[model samples]
Structure formats: C-alpha cells, structure tokens
Target: MPLARTSDLLAAAVADRRGLPAFNVITLEHAEAIAAGAETADTPVILQISQNAVGFHGGRLLPLARACAEVAAAARVAVSLHLDHVEDADLLRAAPGAGFSSAMFDASHLPHDENVKATAEAAAWAHRHGLYLEAELGRVGGKDGEAPLSAHAPGARTDPAEAAGYVADTGVDALAVAVGSSHAMTTRTAALDHGLIGRLAAAVPVPLVLHGSSGVPDAELRGAVAAGMVKINIGTALNLAFTPAVRAHLAENPAVTDPRKYLDPARTAMAQTVAHLARVVAGGGQG
Candidate 1:
C-alpha cells in the first residue's frame, strides 16, 4: 500500500480507543527498523522526523523524508511520515511537500495569544496543503540540545479548557499536551496524571497526543490509551535499544571494521523494541 496519512491512522486508533505508536526516526536504519517492527506486529505506525533530526542530517530533510516515505510505502501495515516538533515557520510550511503527512507546529513556548496566532497560521498552511497539523498548548517538558530545560520551567501541565479553546482557535487536527512526561528521559519512571489526561480528552475537540512518551512505563502507556491518548510519540527508547547493541557488537568483534556488521545488529535490536512498543501501544502485553 501507499503511505498512509497521519489523520487516518489516528482516526482509527481513536475509534478503537487504542494508541498509535509514533517513533522518531534519526537514520535510514531507524526508519527501516521501525517499519519492520510495525510489520512484525501487524500494526500501523507513524515515522516521525524531528527538527533536531533534520539538523543532524546537515539541515536537510527531503533525503530522509523520502527514505521514510519509501519505507512506509513498502510496509505491510499502514505507516505515515510526520514532522515532529517543528517550530520554524518555514520548516512547517515545507513539511507536506517533503512527504510528511502531518506536522506539529510547536508554538507552545510563545505567549498564549501569540502561540494561538502562530499555530493558526501554520495550521491554515498545513490544511491548505491537505496535511494534518498538531499543535502544543504548553511546554511538553524537554529542551532540544544543551539548552537549559529550566528555560521552559518543568511541570507546566496543560489546562483542559484552554486546550479546547486552542484547538478550536488553531483548527489543529491534534493536540500534544504536557501531562508530566519529560522529553529525553532515559528512565521509564514518569508518572502521568491520568485524571488530567481524561479531562483533556473530554474537553479537547481533537485527538490527544503524548510527547516524551518514552519516559512513561509500558503499563502506564497502555493506561494512557485507555484514558484517551490516541497518539504516543517515542524517541529515547529506540535509541536506548540501538546504541547498546552497536556498543556490544563493536566490543565483541574489534576486527569488524565493516559498518553493516555492527549496524545490522543495532537495527535488529531497534526493530524488536519497536515491535514490543507497538504491541504495548495497541493495548497488548509486551509480546
């Protein structure tokens, strides 16, 4: 099948009260591994490329985007490409053309009114291009680089009423809310406020998205879906699986100068992790 749209995947998940796993892809291997995992689990998944990832690719996006689209197209299960946490207006505007079916135009760092205005403008552009737009209402708790996380104050949770109004005002297809999970967390110990999640789901018109979901435990993630989170974005967990595999392979075989020898094992590890996460997101046990 061709690449699926983010809206379509989320819509199905919402109807079934299931969570769609959205994995952040940093390399071609990541994209292939994620797609392989989704195929293994027989579940639909989202392949996300973050703005930070674009920077890592030398300020280029299309090359990786096209690769992800190819992966999605070849996958047995439905797969979509998403541009995640895109703050720059130009980058947001360019996403759909670069093969992203959806984009998150992050203006949550701006003042409320300014955020609304900026998100509305970006949403309009995305809609005009028939793309799904996701907007954040509050700081989703994590800085991109060495930037101080304190710059955005931790624990800034989203207000349900304000979230509804923001979604209404911006015409966004989804909302990424701050519900206690912090970005780039290496430990799966983040305690999400389930009550807040249910309230946000009731109040917000669109589907709710959970960013920094890699911090939340697997059981809690499943509970989050039952509480009405339709889209769960994960990053660090895949990295956690991938990096160790590469390290182990290199340590065991010092003579292995071939990149594929090490990278293949890393990709396999990532694929297994993705498959388990996919099952978890689908409300299945870690199979």
Candidate 2:
C-alpha cells in the first residue's frame, strides 16, 4: 500500500466524527509495531517522528522517515507519515522530500504574534511543497518532564477566538489546541476541557488536534473526540508499554544478551497498546 495523505485521513475522520490516532515513532520497532497495530485494528493511522526523536537519532530525519515510509507502504492498513514538533526550518523543509505527508510546525513557545509569524511562514513553505501543516496554540506544556500549566494559569487553555485568528493568520491545515492535557504524562489521569473543546471546534475553521493525549484517560479521550477532536497524538503511552516490558524481560532473564530477545517483547507490548488505543480512538472509547 502507498502512504495515505494526512489530509484525506483527517477529512474522513472528521466526517465520521471520530478521532484519528497519530502515534510517535522513536525507533524502527516503533514504526513496525504501529503499522502492525493499525493493521490488526483494520484502520488507518499516522506515524509521527518528532524533532527531539530526530535529535536522539543523531539529528538525522531521512533514515527514520524513510524507514517509517517503507513500513507504512508494506502495512495492510492505510498509514501516513508526519513530522511532529518541527521548529527548525531545515527539518521542516526536509519532510516532504523524506516521504512525509504532513508536518507539525511548532511555534507555541513564542508569543502569539511571533508564533503566528513563524507558523505562517512555515505553513506557506509547507503548502508550497504539498504538505499538510499543523500548528499549536495556547502553548500546551510538559514535554520531557517540563512543568505543565496549572489549572488556572493565564493563557493556559486555548481561547476559541484567538485560535480562530491564529489559524486564519497562519493558514495551517490543523490546529492543536491546549485543553488541559500535558505531554509525557505517565499517568492517564489528565482531564480535558470538553466544553472548551466544543467551543474551539465550533470556532476554528479547520480540523482540531489533541496533543499530549497520552495523559488523557479513555473516557476523557472519548469526550474530547465527541466534542470535536479529530487528530489525537499519542507518544508516552507507547513508551510506558515498551520500557516496562524490556525491564521485565531483563529482570526475568538476566543472561539474555541478545537484543532481539528483549526487544521482541517490547515491540509486542507497544503493538498491543497501539491496537487498543486505535480502537479506542476510532470507536470513541468503546474499545
């Protein structure tokens, strides 16, 4: 199968009022497992590679991106490749050429005006290269153990009016709004603002995305989707499944020096998690 267009998948999900799961790819096994999971669930999925993950792999994007593309192409289900949290212009430009259908140009760390300016430029360049662009607003926090916003922090949640204006100014295809979910949360206890999600959905012109969704509980995810979240980005949950399995494998078999022996179980665990989450997202938490 060829790589599916991110826009097409998103459009279909939007029409169906379902959430599309976009899982992060940190390693080749992650890509393989995601594809396998989507295949198992008989649904389309997006495999995303973030800038920080590229940094972890020696600042190279093509190697992993191509690997993900190849894995997606071989999968039984429709799978798209996306570059996530891309702040570097060079890396952003590299996406389309490296087999990505879409890219998230992150400028959320900047002030509103600056974020609009930078994201607008990136979106223009991405459009020119035939890539669907995603941008973030209201600065969802807590990446790599950074402190997340308090419940009452100023500008912590996305204002519908501001988000609409930002999307209009930036010309992004999708918007990741801050609605109380934080990135890299190990516990699935994060509460989403469903009313705010509905408001943002009604206000924004394009599809809505939920980042830091790994922290969100199943019922909260269903509520978010029902409220209008189309794209759900999940990363930490895969890590949570993978790392513990590897640790347990090592604990049980102390002399197992073969990487395959441990990595097999880790990949299996991630695949199971992806399958379940895909069902949960597609079925609106009915999984």
Candidate 3:
C-alpha cells in the first residue's frame, strides 16, 4: 500500500471523535515495530521523525524518512509519515521530497510574536507543498533539559482564546496545546487538564493535539480523546518498552554479541506497547 494521507487519517479520527496516536521513530527498529503494531491492531498510525532523531542519524532526514516510508508502504494498516518538532526551515522544506505527508513546525520555544511569524511562514510553505501542518502554542514542559511545569504554573497551560487566535493567525492544520502532561516523563502519573482540553477543543478551529502524551495514563488518554484531543504524540513510552526489553534480553543472555538478538525482543516489546496504545486511542483501552 502507498503511504496514507495524514489529513485523511486526522479527518477520520476527528469524525469518530477519537485520538490518533503518533509514535516518534529514532531507528529502523522503531519504524518496523510501529508498523507491525499498527498492523496487529488494525489501526491507522502516524510515524513521526523528529529533528532530534535526524540529528542522531548524522543530520540526514531522507535515510530514515525513506525507510519509514517504505515501512508504511508495506504495512497492512493506514500509516502516514510525519516530520515532528521541526524547527529548521530547510528540514521543513525537505519534508515533501522526503515522503512526509505532514510536518510539525515547532516555534513554541520562541516568544509569542516570533512563534507566530515563524510558524505562519512554515505553514504557508507547507500548504504550498501540500503538507498538513501542526503547530504548538504554549510550552509543553520537560523539553531540552527544562524542568517540568507544576500544575499551577501560569505558562504551563494553553489559554483557549489565545490558542484560537494563534491557529487563525498561523493557518496551521492542527494545534498542539500544553494542558498538563510533560515530555519525556518515564512515569505515567501526569495529570491532564481535561476541562482545559474541552475548552481548547471548543475554542480552536483546528484539531487539538496533545504532546507529551506518553506520561498520560490509560484512563487519562481516553478522557483526553473524549475531551477532544485529536492527535496524541507518544515517544518515551516506546523507549520505556524498548530499552527494558533490550536490557532484560542481555541480562538473560550476557554472551549475546549480535545486536539483532536483543533488538528483536526490544522491537517486539515496543510493538506490544504500540498495539495496546492503539486500542487505547481507539477507545478500546481494555484488552
């Protein structure tokens, strides 16, 4: 199958009032596992390649992006390629040729005026190249060695009205809002502001995205979808599953020398996580 359109997947999820799970890919194993899991669950998924992942891959996007595209093409389920958390204009420009159906131009780290200016230009370019664009407004916590935001922090949460204005101003296809969850949290104890999500859903014209969703619990994830979070970005949870599997495999067989020996179990573990999360996002959490 060819790559599924991100716009179509998002539109379908929106119509069903469900959340779409997007997993970040750091390696070929990650892409393979995500595709396998999505196929196993028979759910549509977005395979995201973040800027950091590109940096890890010697600053080349096409090698990994094309690999993911091939993985998506071979998958039985609907799979879309996405450029995640992209701050580089050159990278965003390369997205179309790299087989990305959508891209998130992250300017949230910049001041509001600068964010708007940068994101608007990116959005326009994305539109010209026929890519669906997702943008962040407020700062989601725990990115780039930053401290996690307490629930009471004023800047931790996105203002509904401000988000709506930002969406309108930037002409983005979707809005990633900071509700309560923080990025890279290993524990699943992050409490989401469901009420704020609902308000943002109502206020913003575009689909609402929840970044740092790996920290959100199962029930909270379902609640977020119900409260109108359309896109759920998950990264750490896959690593949580992958890394432990690799360690456990090595512990059981310390003599193993081949990377494939451990990576196989690691991939399988991550696949199971993906399948379970797919069910959860599809409103069938218990299975």
Candidate 4:
C-alpha cells in the first residue's frame, strides 16, 4: 500500500481508541527498517523525520525526505511520511516537495502568541499543498536529535488550556501536547500525567499527539492510549535498539568493512522494537 496521510491514520486511531506509532526515520536505513517492521507486524505506522535529522543528513531535507517517500510508496503496509519538530517556515514549504503528506510545526521555542502565529501560518502554507499540519502548544524542551541530553521537564511541558486555543486558532489537524514526557531519556522510565492527558484530550478538538514518548514506559504508553492520544512519536528507543547491535557487530568483527553486514543487525533489532511498540500501543498481541 502507498503511504496514507497522517490525518487519516490519526482519525482511524482516534475512532478505534488505539494509539498509532509515529517512528522517526533518521536515515535511508531507518526508513527501510520501519517499512519492513510495519509490513511484518501488519500495523499502520508513521515514518517521521525531524528538522535536526534533516540537517544531519545533508544540511537539507531533500535526501531523507525522498528516502521516506520512496520507502512509503513501496511498503506493503500503510505508512505515512511526516516531517516533525519543524519550526522554519521555508523548510515546511520545501517539505511537501520531497513528498511529505504531513508535518509538525514546533514553534514551542517562541513566545506564546508568536508560537500561535507561527503555527497558524504554517498551517496555512501546509494547507496550500494539501498537507496535514501538526502543531505543538506549549514548550516541550529538549535537545535537538543530534544532541547528547534533552532538557528536563520542569519548564518545558505543555499547558492543556493553552493547547486548546493553539489547536482551535491555528487550524491544525493534530496537536502535540506535553503531558509529562521528556525527550532523550535513554531509559523508558519517564513519568506521565494521565489526568493531563485526559484533560488535553478533552480540551483540544483535534486528535492529540504525544511527543517525547521514547522515555515513557510500556504501561504509561498504554495509559496514554487510554487517555486519548491518537498518535505517539518515538525515536530514542529505536536508536538504543539499533545502535547497540551495530556497535556490537562492528566490535566483534573488526575485519567486516561492508556496511550492510553490520547495519542489517541494527535494522533487525529496530524492527523488533517497532513490533513491540506497535503491539503495546495497540493493546494487542503482535501479529
């Protein structure tokens, strides 16, 4: 199946009360691994890339974006390609050109009204290209994807009340809210506020998106689904799963110079993690 729009996937998850997994694709290898996992698991997934990842790839979005589109187009199962944590309007404009069906405008670093205005403008531009727009309400502070440690949660989490206005005023298809998750936590032990999740779900009219979900434990992930999060974004966990395998393969076999031999192990590990996440998010047994 070809890639579907993020809004379509979100709507389906919302109606079914199952949280959809939106996995970040950092490279062409990541995209292939994700498509393989989703096809094998029979789960609809979102293949996403951050602005940070874009810069890392080539200081431009075209390379990874094209990889995402091609991967999604050839995938056996449903896949939606999205650009995430994008604050630059020009980048958002160039995103659809590389075949993104949806994107998130993360203006949380700006002031409140500024964030709102920026989000609205992004929504307008995204709509012009018939793309779905996802915007974050309050700041969810974190280091960029390539950074070492993401900032802690004291001042970065979302405020549900403001989230409602952000969604309504910006005309975004989905809203990413910070209930309690923090970014770049290598471990899955971050605490979440179920009450806040429910409140934000009730307050915001659009389907709720949970960012920084890599730090959230399995139980909390299920609780987030119960609390009405339709789309959940995860990255670091897969990185953890993939990186160790690649490192171990390289360490164990120093003579292996071919990238494929080591990368396949990493890809397999990431596929297993994706399967686990899909099942946990859906509250169902893996296929």
Residue 69, candidate 2: Cα error in Å is: 0.6
Every candidate's lDDT: 0.87, 0.89, 0.89, 0.81
**Candidate closer to the true structure by lDDT (higher is better), 1 or 3:** 3
Clashes of 1: 0
Better of 3 and 4 by TM-score: 3
Reference-based TM-score of each model: 0.94, 0.94, 0.94, 0.92
On a 0 to 1 TM-score scale, where does candidate 3 land against the true structure? 0.94
lDDT at 252 for candidate 2?
Answer: 100
CA shift at 196, candidate 2, in angstroms?
A: 0.5
Residue lDDT tens for model 4, 78-168: 8888988887778888877788889988777666666778888889988989999987765522335321111224345566776776677
Which tens-of-lDDT digit does each residue in 67-101 have in candidate 2?
99899999998999999999899999889999898
Collision count for each candidate, in order: 0, 0, 0, 0
lDDT of 4: 0.81
Off by over 4 Å in 4: 139-155
